[model samples]
Every structure is written in C-alpha cells, then in structure tokens.
Target chain A: MKYKDYYEILGVPRDADDDAIKKAYRKLAHKYHPDVSKDPAGEEKFKEIAEAYATLKDADKRAAYDRLGSHSPGQDFQPPPDWGTQYGEQDLRFEDIDLSDLLAGLAGGRQRGAGRRGTMAMPGEDYEVTARISLEDAYAGTLVDLNLSVPEYDANGRLHRVPRVFKARIPKGATHGQRLRLRGKGGKGFHGGRDGDLYLNIELVPHALFRPSGHDLYLDLPLAPWEAALGATVAVPTLAGTVHLKVPAGTAAGSKLRLSGRGLPTPHGKPGDLYAIAQIAVPPKLSEAERELFQKLAAGSTFDPRSHFNSEVKHGD
Target chain B: MATEPVEPAWLNDDARVSLDELAALSGLTDAALRELVDYGVLHPVDAAEAQWTFSARWVVVARTACRLRNDFELDLNALALTLSFLDRIRDLEAQLRSANAQLPRRHY
Candidate 1:
C-alpha cells in the first residue's frame, strides 16, 4: 500500500507541462523498453514507467493524485475517507491495472466497470507460458502433460490462481523458440465474452549425445587410434536408432562426416542430416610386449608430425 | 473420474485474427487501430476497416504499439515507425541466432 509518486518516477517536475512530461516519458520508455533493452530490470522499469504515465497523462487522475500533497514514493499514507465520495467511482477506469490499496481506494476499490449496471463483458487477456521439451521429443512427436496455474475470478470478484492440468501433443520438428498457439485456451472471459488464446513458447532441452544446429544434429563419434588410422565401419547413434557409419581411411580428428536424412524430420522440406565428428581415443596403459612393439615401430618409422611447424614459425618471424 | 486430455489447436503464422479479437487482446481501441491502419502500421486481410482482419503475429505488434502509445504519447505515424524498427531488430536478432547456431564448434 505504498503511495507512488508518478512525477518523480517519470523524472519530471510536478509543474512540468504536457510536452515536457511526454518527452521525459518517451526517453525513459525507449531506454527501458523490454524488447530493445538488454537490461535485466528493463521489464520491471518499463511497467513502473507505464503505470506512472497512466496516472499522470490524464488531467483528472493527475488532479486527484496531486491532491494528496507531499507524499513520497514507498511512504505509505492512506487516502482520506472522503476520497471515494469525491471521485464518484465513475470517473476512474484504470483498465487492466492492478493498483495498490492506496490507489485502489481512490477508485473506490473497483478496478474496472465504473458506471455500468449489468454484467460487464470483456475478452480475457491472452496468456503465454514456456514449454520445455527434450530434443528427442521435439525430433519425434510426443504427448506432454503440463500443469499450469491459471488465474480465475470468484463470485466476489476476487482473483485467485487455480492449478489446472492438461496434456498437449508436441508436434514433430518443433524447433527451439517456436511458438504454439492454442485458441480459446487462455484466461476465462468476463461475462459472455470470448476467452483469449494461449501461447506456448517452445524450448528444446539440450541432449546428452547430440547437439542440434538448425534442423541438423551433431554427435562426437569416438574411435580408437587404429580405427582412425585405418578405415572402419562404426555404429552411430541417431534419434531413430543406431546405424553403421563408414569412417573413411586416415580419418583425422575433428573431421565431420555427414549422414544424410538421419536427423530431425521437419513438417515441410527435407529432413536434416546428422554429422558424426571423429574423435581419436588411445589406450591409457600398454603391456610390456605392446610397448616394445610400439618402440620398435617408432624407431623404424620416419614420420614427422611437427615437420611443418618449424617452417611456419620461421615464416611468421 | 479421469478428465479428458486437452487437445491443442495449433495456429500457424498465416492464421488470421479478427479485428474485435485483436482489439480485445491488445487493449487498443477501435479508433486507435484505425489510426494505425491509416499510418500503414497494420496490414489487414481486407481493404475495408470495418471488416479488417489482422495476422496472428499482429496481435503482439498491436500490444507493443499500445504500450508505446501509452508510455510515450506517440502519434500513430511515430508508433508505426517504431514498431517497424522493432520488427526489423527482431528479424536481425533471429538471423544472428541462426547464424551463430551454425558456427562450427571449436574443440581445444
């Protein structure tokens, strides 16, 4: 029940003109706009600015707010008892704004519907929720169960959030950051108005074995030193199942081999390819005989891995 | 008794939302929407204002425009320009994300 100072929040003098107020608000709005701003507090700041602008922009609301003299932001002071009688409730219609007790008291505790008699009809506000699914589930369609707490207005016109559970089918090829809209599944409408739509923002959970890029999938394929040096057919794991991948002879570490049409399937266009990246693994320990064979091979071999390094270093200098 | 499972109604990008629905969802008055139309902010399905229908994505645009108008006291034309710029910025950011996602992973 804090008394918010609208003028102070907008950084404008109490006696500032409409044009000056508008200019200040615009500057702050641009700075704190949630879409454009990188600030983590931008959304909250934008809401505060919007609330301040909402009250100060209208002359009647400004006059009413100005009457409560010298009250600072966050310093709680109740409105005078005669406040409701003077405003007549009908003049105040702060649409969709949930005000504090002090501000709500000025409007006679009614947020909407000032002079209306019968049941007011207004469409419900749209609701958005994030839905996180596994990359595999996104690759292959799956039914997901979601538990959501939805706000409902009781008979006494008080709002309460009630939990509801439902199941939704995640269509195959659903990408990260995609939005799935469900019509008429949002907040309940007031009176006989239509309910709002529900939007589900999709987020793909990172897979342990696969990393998705666009529609394609990438996985690290581990190979022994001999297998990497000489070609071998290795079983690679895909979303569907394991398939044999042919690793060409002399495959170097970090080499990417593409397996066409083995990745996630899209609704339209061709399915994406899966890439197997070569990773060479060596034995940590060797027996005496193995060590002796390796030493003999090293003595006989004339291969120099760092032959180009000295030449490159000389050229750089 | 077990409750029936909820079946989601998937709406694509091409889905059209009615004017009344857009007005209710965006909290924008009909007059303000008309002004936005005059400024070429919204492209309706039809030419006539009374029978105007907006794309589903325009719902978000209209809501952003309403907030901008309320906070900044911007006229319809300025609001339209701002919304256009915002849209362009969003498109560029999405493109950047896609490009970054395609970059090869470096293993050190």
Candidate 2:
C-alpha cells in the first residue's frame, strides 16, 4: 500500500487540536470545493482534503488511522488478527467514520467511494432549513442571524432545545428560489462521523406595491382625465425610490411608460426595466353646483363627440 | 449642428400586402386563414370562389391569437371568440377616428 499522510495533506501538525483540524478542513474545503474552485485539479484536491478531514475529524478514527500508518490502507495491510476484539468491538459505523460510501449516500449519490477508513463512519450529518427575507432584503442582499432550534436529549435523557445562532452572509444577487449551504452544521456523528451540512432555502416575502415581471417591475398609475389627455409628468413609485415619470403630451390611457434600469437585478447580472401604465380616473356622482358647471360647459361647447357616427351611417347606407 | 428631417415620396401611405404577402407574413396555412374568415374575424376581399384574397389586417388577428395562446394560455376556440369582440372594438375605433377629423371652425 502507498504511504498516505493525512496530517501533511491537511497542513497541520502531528498533534494538532480538534479546533485547529476543523478550521483547516473548512479552509481547505472552501478552497478545493468544485462549485467555487477554478483550479484544474479542484476535484482531486477536494478528495484529498476530504480524505484528510475524515480521518482527523474524530478522536477514535484518528487514533485508528494513526495506528494503521497507511492513510490509503489496502487489503494487504493487517493489524493484529484480533484488532476488533482488542478495541472492544468498537462500532466502526460510529458518527466520525469517514467512509466514502456513507458520505456519498448522505450527499445524494454524488460522491463515489474513495475515502475508506476501515468500517469507520464519516463525520457529520446534513440538515435542511429555510431563510425567509423580504423582497427588498433579497434585492439589496443582507447579512442575517439564522437561529436553529434543534431538539436533543441531554445526559439525563431529558429532551431539550439546543439553540444555535449562525451569522450567514447572503450573496448580493440571491433570488427567492435559490439555496445556500452551511457546511458541518447538521446532526452529530454516531460513532465519530463528521456532522452533516445545513441547507438553507430562501423564501422571499411578498410585496404590496412592487410586482415582479421578468426582472422588471410593473405599476398601474391612476391619472386624472386631463393628465391622460394632456401629458403630465407625474411622481411614480419604484423599487429603489420615487421618480418623476414623463407622460408624453397627447398620451392616452393605458399608455405604458418605461423606466430603464429600475427593475430587479437578475442573477444573470442584467437589470430589468419598470413599466408604468396610465389609467384615466373619472369623477363619480356630481353635486348640484358641479352639475351646473358641467351643464353650462356642455351648452357652450360646440364639440360633438358623436358626429362621426352620422358620416358612418351615410356611407353605410 | 442640428440635422434637417427628410421627407419620403410616399407621404400618408399605409403599409399594404398582397394576398401572397399576407399569407407569408401571417405564417398561417390557407386553411387556417379560411378558419379565421369562417369565424367572421377576418374578411378578405373575394374575387372568385377559388381566388379569394386576404389583407394585412389579418396580421393583428394572428398576433392577438398568438399572444392569447402563449401569454394567457388560451385555446384556439376562445381566442376566436375574443377576436370577434375585438373586431367590434376596431369598427368603433374607426368611427371615432373619422369623427375626430371633422370639427366646426371657431374664430379666435
């Protein structure tokens, strides 16, 4: 069997502390993770880091690996004939075991069998939770404290809530349907496996004023009849702030005004536009004085709106 | 420096299409255009039984049909009925446009 050095791969001292090992694993994992890493050897480097982490993450597995001397142990490598009995039949399936099959299973069959530490279980379990943010918060992005209340049994076997607060930095272009993952924060290992990760599903709260239309926002602006007839610049509301919208002279009702770059910034990095459609509002039931003014205006006005109907009837006849 | 506007020879000209051009632009089969005519939404100028011809006005009907199908997820039958209502609205709009052209003169 080839000589595999777990300590050398993790860049840690022979007798490094547990906290130091965990910190090293996180740093190496982030550096080598295929999702974020651009190196040509990213996958291979990630496997090496995971292999080192699997062994060093747990006390018992680390001791067993230390005893084995071969990080990549082969079938030919033999400890004492009665190694299991000597270890008092320690459940190799303990939570800290870093076996490849178990990790692959927990990761939903993405990982292939590679890291083999006897029957030692992998460290950590994976968990899923949701993060709810406002649409505004999602638009601007935010750093928020996510509180997780996990139920566990104490030393006396009494059930209690284990409260944990993690500060998560949401990415700038995080959308409502996207997911974020926190590594090694899930259920504890059985014997000595690494704890799983926590998957965060983001939920965006609905907004009252802003309606999303393919990265663009849409708004219905109610305008007076005169404003629709004679175009007027009106103050309109947008996701960022209020802005004056130019209503072209002779603008009709239902005419849409576009404000470029006022829409949500999509994950693809392109910004959407905001569309404001104008609608004319008519006055309801007039008072006696208001009725007289309209009556006088109608009597004095020579504009007959229905006169075109007379020409159409003559042409049809 | 400000640039002067150019005038075209075809002033007050509207876009027009021959029967073949209409069929090419509309992308509908001959039978489909007949289906639109049968529904009374499209009225093509008829010369003879086999020599019937359509106009570019059918472009609006075809485009509205596409919008109903793709955007609003409406089926062909419902779209045909909606186009009938839209035809009535077009006739009313044409009447209004003609009426706006003639106004009594006023001396100020």
The DockQ figures for the candidates are 0.30, 0.01
Error of 2 at A127 (Å): 2.9
Q: Which candidate's lDDT is highest?
A: 1
Tell me how candidate 1 scores on lDDT: 0.72
Candidate 2 ranges beyond 4 A from true positions: A1-119, A151-161, A183-195, A250-253, A284-317, B1-108
Residues A25-128 of candidate 2: C-alpha lDDT, one tens digit per residue: 77886677643465859767986887678767767667755665544432334444454454444323323222432223222232322122224554444445
* Tens-digit lDDT string for candidate 1 (A95-159): 33234322433443244431133267666767666789898888888877667666666564545
Per model, kept true contacts as a fraction are: 0.34, 0.00
Tens-digit per-residue lDDT, B1-108, candidate 2 = 111211111000123344564454344556655676777766766635566655434554564454344423345677678777766775675556434322211111
Model 1 chain A, poorest ten-residue lDDT window? A109-118
Give candidate 1's iRMS in Å, 1 decimal: 4.5
Two-chain complex of model 1, DockQ on C-alpha atoms against the true structure: 0.30
The iRMS of model 2 comes to 25.9
Error of 1 at A133 (Å): 3.8
